[model samples]
Target chain A: MDRQRFDYLLEAYGADFARWPDGEREAAAAFAAAHAAELTEVLQAARALDAALGTRRVEAPTPDLLSARILAAHKRQRGAGLDWRAAAALAACAVFGVALGYGGGLLAPVADDGDYFASAFETPFADYDGDEG
Target chain B: MIDPDADLVRSAGAGDAQAASALVRRHLPRMVALGRRMLNDAAEAEDVAQEVFLRVWREAPRWKPGAAKFETWMHRVALNLCYDRLRRRREKSDPDAGLYVADGAASAGDAWLARQRVAKVGAALAQLPERQRSAIELVHFQELTNIAAAETLEISVEALESLLARGRRALKAALADVAQDLIGDADGVPRV
Candidate 1:
């Protein structure tokens, strides 16, 4: 890599070779080896920033409580999801039961052919009783 | 992509409790670190990390691989959470309020000096425009690959490089006085 590309790589990845893009790293490293003096100055400047950036250390979450909380939350969410699925399955079963019952009734021999039309009209009790008398 | 966590992620998505725990344990530290660096508040960072894990739990079952690496997705979620807090901070900005306190107890010695330097660098970083600061944090501090960081930021690699260049230049300028302290030699060579 030329100085321009090398500088760009330095800016993009700081002074860390491992952080640099894979393909150009060899070229960049070779250039650094070739132009040791110039590269050292640039590398130093980048490293200073990297060093300063490194100083801010964030404490990891306390192992016991944090992990427990995370897993508990996971379980709670999964449980809720399961609950919904269970409810859905129950509803589906209910619908299927009603459908199956209806279909079975339809498939069975007709108790009365007039049964279908029987519910279509409502007759006063007096008319039925008078006709029977 | 060959995600190291792909197996754990798949197991977690299948509702394996142990797998879920493993995934949480695996990714939580980096998420917390990213949150802390982006937000500069330990408690808030923890909250962000928790929120990220919570999302993971909810989405894991529906998680479809080949879309993106799980850790990359986690970073995106964590960054988004940080951005939300940051926006809230801006809205509630108070001139009287200090953005950051001294990092720790100050005492005479190199330790205190080191803390001071870190604080100075932090303050400079905080002063940068949010995008520039984020670019620097993701690539430099978080050690995300340029491509991954760009994906996290929803920007092109070239744009990310531009931001890095600008961010680093700004950082150097901001810490110009401390440059000598950073590297002892005027030629920018480290004494070590």
Candidate 2:
């Protein structure tokens, strides 16, 4: 058989591939049925291998162990997160303190009248009164 | 299949506890099986599997989703673990280069040709090179597509075919002895 056809047949008969598309699988199977004899010996060999490598499933770690490990790592991570959050919070507080001390009017103006008096004191009328007095 | 909550992968990568357990639970069995087959020693395989997952957890932060599949990458990681375990097995001078047992599997299973009748098959397998063994294992046992299996081995598909052909021919010749054992009373049975 031609290499291309044979390759198709191999795919059809199946190799130890983890997954394959359906249409391709069907095509391969058809090719193999037609060329059974020519492919027999090799197919048998492959089959034997397939049989020998069985899926002997093993045990996973128990939940407690899993949880302990997870929690341990979680705790460590939590601690790390706390540290980061603390650092960020401290930085934010420091910035706020600086703004309050030096930025002036750290809070929005609560009284509307304060600015009016301050502006009025600087006006020409106030200057004239102060000079006359 | 991936963990539904890949958040575990992220947290575990960054050293989260519950995430670590979840990651372990999600991956341990498959990894163990891979390790078991690769190293052929259950304990050793378990250790390798543990190490593989640990590395995966460590690598979670660097995972590039589109570059390649996360599972394919994991398979590659498992393959590397297997290779490392193979080397470690050889270093200690264990017999058969650490190939796993020829567990009896049904011929009907995945259309597997039964090894129950072919004792020489296992021996021949043990005698084959590790590359050949991996090629066989992935294709026959794991049932991976040629291209995918090749990727797992970091080899080209043509190279995989070459290895398989060579391996098959060797198996046929090696298993010839079992011909007698299989057809003890061949009088009625059709002859080739």
CAPRI quality level assigned to candidate 1 from its DockQ score:
acceptable
Candidates' RMSD to native: 8.5, 12.6
The numbered model that scores best in DockQ is 1
Chain A TM-score compared with the true chain A, each model in order: 0.61, 0.45
lDDT of 1 by residue, B117-161 (tens): 656776777778888988887887678898988888889989998
Instruction: Give the TM-score (0 to 1) of chain B in model 2.
Output: 0.64
TM-score of each: 0.77, 0.58
DockQ of each: 0.27, 0.08
TM-score of 2: 0.58
Give the per-residue lDDT of model 1 (tens digit) for A33-87: 9999867778888887776666565554444677788899988877887899999
* Model 2 per-residue lDDT tens digits across residues B34-124: 6655565656755666566656755776655555555556677877777876675553333223333343353464223332342235456
